[model samples]
Target: MNVRTHILRRNNTGGIFHQRGVAALLLVLLVGISATVVTLGTMSYVRGSQKSQLTVHGQTQAEINAWSGAEALGQYLNGIEVETVTTAMDDIVFSRDNQTIASAQYKPDCSQTSRDLYCFDVNGISAGHNSNLEVVYQIPIIRDVSYTEISNPIVIKGDTEVTGGGMAYLSSDSIDGFAVDGNLTITNATKSIASGCATGNIHVNGGGVEDNGHLYSSNGDITLEGLNLVGADIWGGNINVLAGSGFHFKSIKAVKNLKVTNAGNFKSDFIHANAVSFALEGQLGETLVHSDIAFGNGKSHLDYLEAGGNLIFHQDDQSHVPEFTRNSKIAGKILLRTGEDGNTLSTHYNSTFKNIEQGRTATDPGVPEWPECNVDATPFDVNTLISQANYIFYIDESDKPMLKIQNVKRASDDKSIDATINLSSEGGMNTAYLHNKPFFQCEWDSKSCITSKSNSTDGWVFEGVTHFPPGVILFAGKGNPNQRNLAPMNFTLASKSEKVGPLLNTILVTGDITLGRGGGRKEIHAPYFSSPDAVCDGDFYPANLCDKSSGSWQFEGKWDGDRVERNYPVANTSIMVNHTMTSEGWSLEGSVIVGDTFKTDSNLTNVHGVVVIGLNSDEGGMKITQGGIVVDFMDLDSNFLNIPTGNTQVTDESTLGIPTAMWARYY
Candidate 1:
C-alpha cells in the first residue's frame, strides 16, 4: 500500500511541477510584452522631441537670417533716399532659393507725407519653405548705369562729343559744325575742333589752332579770346574784342561790322576794318587817336584838338562812322562855355554874360569873339574869388551864415566889397545896425533873426527865398564847404556820341531847423538827413547828433540885411522827379530816379545790397527806363553757369560726383 501511495504522490508532484513551469513561462512572456511596449513608447517620445527641436532650430535660424536681411536692406536703403525703419521691415524673407526679400512699406497712420512706416518677417522657416538655405540676405537696389539723350543743346563743363551734325564751337574748344542754327560755345578745350558748315554762329574763347586752320561763320557772331591769328582769317558777320582779352589781330578787316570794347582802362592802338559801320566804346584814360572821329547825329561839344591828325569832328549816323571809312581826314572845331545852363552861358571867346530873353538868341556885345576870346593867360580861380568877402548873410534860422557885405567899392572893371565882415553868428539879431539903406533891413524873432539887404539896385537884393527841399541832403561844414557839401544835382551833359539828360538830383540840408516839444515827437529821416535836436542833433557825420528840443521845423529866408524868422524853408515846386534809392550801407529816402549802372558785390560775405525803390504817396516811383545788367570779364565762349548735370545721376566719378550746374532766374 505504501509503494502505491508514493508512486501516486510522485506523479502528482510531477504534474504540479509541470503546472508551475507553465505559469512561469506565461509570466515571463507577459513581462516581456510590457517591457517591449514601454521601450517602444519611450522611443516614440524621443523621436517626436527630436523632430520638434529640429523645427525650432530651423525657425530660429530663419529668424536670424531674416533679421540680418532687414539690417542689410536698411543699410542699403540708407544711401538712396530718406527711408524710415517702420517702412522698411515688413514682408522681409530669408531664403536661399529665391534669394530675394522685400519688407512691407509702412504708411504713417497720421497720413504725414514727410514720414514713412515699415515691418519685417522671415521666410526660410515658413510653413511652405523648401530651401536648403544656410542663410539669405537682402540688399537695396542701387542704380549702377544710366543712358540719356538730350534733343537740344547740352552744355557740359568738361567736354562733350556729338556724333551727329551740329555746330558746337565757342571760345574754348573744338566744334563740329553742320547747319548750325544755335549759339555755340567751346571755351577752354584742347581737342575740340570738329566740323560744322551751317549758317549758325560760334564763339570760341581760347583754342590754340585748328588742324585745318580755318574759322567760318555765316550770318553769325564770332568772338575769339586769347588767340594768336598768325595768318588765320575769321570770316564772321560780326566780331568784337578787348585789347587785353587775349585777342591779337594781324589786321581785323571785316566785310560786315566790327565793335571793340576796352575794359582795362587801355586803348586799342591799331584798328583797320572794312565795314559799313563801326562802334568804339571805351574809356579814354591816356590814349592817342590816329583816325578821324565822327559823332552820332546829336548835339555835342568840342573842347580841344591836340591829336597828331586833323581832329575833324562831324555828326553822322551809326552806319556811316567816319573812322571806318577809307578816305577820312582830320578837321578841327573847338568851343568852350561856362555857366550852369547850356543856353545863355559865357563862351571862352566872350567875357560879357548873356541872358536868355524870349525866343531870340544874342551874345553879349561887350565880349570878344572866336580867336580874340582865347586868353590862355587869364586868371580865374574859383576858390580865391570868394576868399575875401564882406557880407554876413543869414537865412531864416540857419546856423550856417552866408556872405555879408560891409562896404561896397566899384573898381574900373570889377566890383569889390570891404574885406571886414564877421562870419560867425548864433541866433540873436544884430543889436546895432551900422548900415541900414533902402535896400537893407534886419529883423529878429524867437527862433530866428537875420540882417540882410533886399533891393533891385546894385545893393544886395534878397529875393526868391532859399528853401530846403524834402529829400536826402549832404552837409559840409564851413571848412572846404564846396567839395561834397551837397548831394549831386541833375545836370544835362551833351557829349559827342550821346546826350544824357539830368542823371541825378540835389538834396536839401537844413542846419537850424528844430521839431516841436516832447523829445520823441520829432521825426527824422535817417541815413540822408541830420537832426539837430534828436539823437543826432541836426548835425550828422563825425558823430550822431541828438536834438534836445522838439519843435515843428519852419523855413526862414534872409539876405545881407533882410532877415525873416519863423518861416518854413519850402522847396521849389518845380517839375522834379522822385528818386528810388537802394540803400546798401546808408539810408536814401524820398522819390528819385535810380541809374541803371548800380553796382552790388555778390561775393562780399557781409556786405548787403539794400535798395529801396519807390516811396509811399509819391506822384511817380523811380522808373527803370533801360538797363540793370552785369557783364562778366570771362571769354564770350565761357559761361559761368551753363554747365550740365552730368548723366543726371549721382556717381563716384569725382569728389563732388556731378558737374556743377549754372542757373539764372528772374524775380
Candidate 2:
C-alpha cells in the first residue's frame, strides 16, 4: 500500500527538482560569464600597459639617437677643411634603426638664407604599440665662419656667383687657391672670402676685377675698390685703383711704377727700386721712397716727399730738371744728370740735403766730383765724431763689397764733434753693435770732458749716452741702391738681462736730444754713433735698423712712424706707435723721453701717451738723465700713488679693531 502512494509523490518531486536544477544551471552560467568578462578586461589592460612601455622606450631611444646624430653632424662640421668644402662624407654616420625617424634637406645654394643651422625637429605620430616616428634634421649654414682646422690647397673657381650671402674661411695652415675661370660675380654685400695662409700663396686669376681685397692676378695685385690688405709681402705687380682710394700695405715691393692717375692714398713704405719713375697724383703719408725716386708732375699731388736715398733730377718732357736749393735734409748722395739739358734745381717744398754732393747752401752751390766727400779717411774717435755734428752720412764705394764694422759706437750722449763718411772701393763695414767689447773707446779730452765731482782735480768724466731723438734717414747711390752694399741705419748690442731681447738693430726714438741731466744722476750712458764719411770706394752690407735686439734701448717715449714692427725679425706689425700728450692726446708728432712719467701735467692734466719698455728693472724705477726733456701729467702716476690718511695708525691688538696674526711684518 505505501509503494503505490510513494510512486505518485515521486513524479511530483522529480518535476520540482528538475526546475531547481534548471535555475541552478542558469546561475552557474551567469557567474562564468562574469568571470570571463573580468579576465578579458584584465588581459586587455596588461597588453595595453606592455604596448605603452614599449612605445615610451622606443621614443626615448629615438630621441637619444637624434642627439647622437646631432653630435655626429657637429663632428662632421668640425672636421671639414677650413677653406675647402667637404666633397664626400668625411665621417657622417646615422643609426641604422633610427635612420627612418628623420630626414634632412640640404641647401647647397650659398646665396640662400635658410634657418637650417638649428637642431632637428622631431614629429611623433602614433603613441601606441605600433608607432610611426618622423624626424626632421636641419642643414647647417655658416655665418662668420672661422677656420680652426688644418688647411689644404682649396681652389674656389668658376663664375661662382654668390648672389645673396656667403662666407669663406682660410685659417692658419690653410691656403685658398682661388681660380676665377669665368667672371665670378659676388654681389653679396656681406660675403667675404678671408684667406689666412700659414705658408702658401693665394694666387688669384688675372682680369678678375674684384670689388674687395686682391682683385685679380696670378701674382697678388691690389685691383679691388675697397680692400684692406694685411699681407707680409705685398708685391704690387700692377696696382690700379680709383682716385682718392685707400691702399694700405705692410711691405710693398713694386716692380713696376705705381701710377695714381686720380687722387689716391698710399700709406706705407715704397722700397727696393733703382728709381721710382712714376707720376704720383695722390696724397702720400710717410712716403719712404727708396733708391733714386725720379718724380715728375702730371696733375700729381704729393703729400710728403721723404728722400732716404740720393735723389736724381731729370725732366719728364725735356724740361729743365728742378733741383732742391734750400737746406734739404737728404740722407744719401745726390746725382743730377741733366741728360744733355740744363741742370736747374728747384724745391716744390723746403727740403734738406743732408749728404749733398752739390747742393745750394751758398757755399757749395755747384755739383761736386764723384768723390765729393772723403774716402779711405781716418777713423775718428766716438767723442770727436759726436761733437759739432752738423750732419751724418754714409756712402757706397765697395764693388760687391759688404761693408762690415764691428766694435764701433752706434750712439753717444755727448755731442762734441760732427761726422762724415765715404765708403772705400774695397768695401768697408760700419757696424755699431759691440759684441763683448765696448761700443767705443771713451778717452776724456781734458778740455772737452766734464768733471763728475765738484773738485776740479777729478778726472775727465765719460758721459753715458742718453736717448737719441727719433729720425728717419735715407741713403742713395749713383747707381742701383739694392746693388750697392749699404748698412742698416741703426744697430744695437745684446743686453745682460734675460727679459731684454738680443742686440737691437732698429730703435725708433720719440724724444728730444738733451745734453745734461738732473743733479746726482750720472750720464745715462747708452753708446750710439754717427759716421758721415768713413769710406769712398765700393759697397758694404747694412744691417737692419730698429730690429728687436736683446740689449736695445727702452722705447719709453712716444713713437710715431709709418709702421711699427712688434715681433722678432719684424713678424708682427702695428700701424702706428700710439702716443699721447695734453694738446696732442694721441699725436703722430712729439718728442718722448725714456723713463718719463708719461703722466698728467702739474695742472692735474694727462700728458702724452708714452710707451716704456725695460729689459730688467727689479725696482721698477728707471734712471733718467737729469735735464732730459720729459712729458708728464698729474694723472699719469695716479695708479701707483696712494694717499694715506694722517689719522690712520698701525695696530696689532686682536681686540683693538685691528687684524692680528699678521705675518711678514717688516717693522
Candidate 3:
C-alpha cells in the first residue's frame, strides 16, 4: 500500500510542472504580439511626419521663385513698346539657369491713354495665390519734332489770300517753312509770306496753333492780306483775295473756295479750289485751276480751267468763262470748268477757248484731307520734360552763362548717361568761368584766387563720380529773375569735340539765348569791383560793350595744356548754343534752339546740326537776312535730348536706372 502512494505523488508532481510550463509560454506570446503592434504604429507615424516636412519645403521654394520672377519682369518690360507687349505677351514663365519653373500671366489696363497698367498672376507651391499684381508704367518725358516732306503747290486752307497794294516783299530773313497747328490769317499788306506753310484740319485735340518751323499749321481759314508767295505752298481752308491783292509766286489751293478780286502776277502749274470767283483785273498763271464754282466776271484770265459747277466769264453783256493758249502773252491761262464740258466753253469780246489742252482737264489734283499735319512718334511731351529736369537754367536771362562739359556715356543698354559735369554757375576749381570776363582771368582787374589766374582751359580735366546712379536729371536753376535778353553773360567753350560731341556742357539754360544784337547793341555790364548784383546794378562795362559785334562767345578748345591755341570763339565746336540763339554771324556749327526767336537777320545762317524753334522772337520766327539758311537735317539723327542725365551705373537693378512707377492703381 506504501509503494502505490509514492508513485501517485510523483505522477501528480509531473502534471503540475507540465501545467506551469504551458502558462509561461502563453505569457511570452502575449507580450510579443503587443510589441509588434506598437512598432507598426510608430513606423506609420514617422512616415506621415516626413511627408508633412517635404510639403512645407516645397511651398517655401515656390514662394521664393514667384518673387524672383516678379523682379525679372520689371526689368524686361522697361523701354518696351506698349503695342509689342499687348500683342506678344501672355503667361510668363520664370526660370532659374534657363530652367522654367514658376509661371506668371500679365493683364494690361489700356484705359489711360498716357500710361499703361500691368497685372501679374503667379501660382505657388503653397495653397495661397495672388490675384492682385504689381503694376509698372514706363513713360517717356519728351521728344523732338521732325520736318520732312514738302507739300505740293496750290495748298490753301480757308480764304488764304493776301491782297494789298502796299506790296509784300520776300526777305532772306524769313522763315523757310512755317507749320501752324490751327487757323492762320495774315492780313498785313506789309506782311511778307516767306516759307511754305501747313495747317491742321481739326482745331481741337490736335490743335496747337503755332507759326512754327517757318511753315506748319493745322486748321482754319488761312486768309491773306498781302500775299508774297515765293517757293511756298499754303495749305488750309478758304482762300480770298479781296479788292486788289496779288500773289507773285507759286500755288494757292484750298479745300473750300478761292475768291480773287483784281489779283496780280500769280504763276503756277496747279491750283485747286472748291469754288473760284475772280473779278476785275486778275492775272492768271499758265496752270490748271479746278473749282466747284468758277466765275470770271471782270478781266480775270485763266490758262486751263476745271470747274465743277457753273463756268462763266461775264464781261458787260457776255456770260461765259474764257480759256486761252498755254503760251499766251497774258498773265494767266483760260478757264475750263472742272464739272463743265470743255465743248460748252465761251468768252466775251469774241475771245476763243481753242488754245487749251483737252487732256489736261481729266481729274482735279485733289487737296489732301484738311489738317494734313504729321506727328512724331516719340513717347514724351517736350514742354513737360524740360520743366521736370533736376537742373534748369535760363541763359541770357540773367547773363549768358558758360558751360564746361566733361563727358557723356551710355552706362547700360537701356540708359545713356554723362558723368562729368561742370556747369558755368557752379564752375569747379581750375575751370575757366567766362560769364563775367572771357578776355581776362579771375575777376576784371583783380589778382584774387576766386578764379584761375590764367585764362587757359587746355588743362581742364573732368572729375568722375561713382556713387550717383545713372539717369538722374540735373536741372540748372532759372536764376533769380526770369531769363530775359541775356545781355551781361557770355560763355566760353573749351572745345573737346574729339572727346565730347557738341552737347550742352553739363549746363542748360531754359530761356532765350541772345548772343549779339543786329547793329552793335549787345553787352552785359557786370564789372567785378562790387558784389555780383551790386555790380550789375551799378552798371559797369562800356555802354556799347553789348554791341552785336562784341557779343561773341569765346573759345579756348585747343588749349595745349599750357596756352590756348586761338583767341577766336568757335560757334559749335565744343559748345552747344542752348535755347534761342540770336547772333550776327552767318555760320552755326553746333546745335541751336530758339524758344522765342532765332533771328540771324545780320546775315545768312548756316546750321551744321539741329536748329529748332520753340518760339519765334522776330515778327516771324527766324529772319536770315541774306545767304539763305542751309540746314544739314542730318544733325537730327542723334539722341536729341541734351539734358544731362548723370552717367553712373546701377549694376544690381536691371532697369538701367530708368524711371518706373508702381502706378498706385490696384486690382
Which has the greatest TM-score?
A: 3
Worst 10 residues of 3 by lDDT: 48-57
Candidate 1 structure quality by residue, lDDT tens digits, 536-648: 22211111011122454322122112111111111110111122122111112111112211221111101011111111122212111111111111122212111111112
Residue 520 accuracy (lDDT) in model 3: 24
Q: Is candidate 1 or candidate 2 better by TM-score?
A: 2
Positional deviation of 258 in candidate 3, in angstroms? Answer: 1.5
- Count backbone clashes in candidate 2: 99
- The root-mean-square deviation over C-alpha atoms between each candidate and the true structure, in angstroms, is 40.9, 37.6, 26.7
Every model's TM-score = 0.19, 0.21, 0.38
lDDT of each candidate versus the true structure: 0.24, 0.24, 0.32
Deviation from native of the Cα of residue 260 in model 1, angstroms: 14
Per-residue lDDT of model 3, residues 1-667, tens digit only: 0000000111212231122111211111111111110111100111110001000011234443443444455545543445545555677665545555456565555434233234455443223543223334333322221222222211122222222211121223332333332233333223332344444331111111122212334455554433444444544577655433335435556667666655565444446656566654344564333434345544445565544334445433333435454532222233343324333454333345445333333445344455455321111112232312222222323333332111112212212221122334354422222223221122212222223311222111111111111111222322322112222222222111222112221122333333332322122211111122221111122111011223442221223322121111111221122334455433444444443344443434454433444322222244333223444433232222221111121122211112233321113
Highest lDDT, which number? Answer: 3
**Cα-lDDT of candidate 1:** 0.24
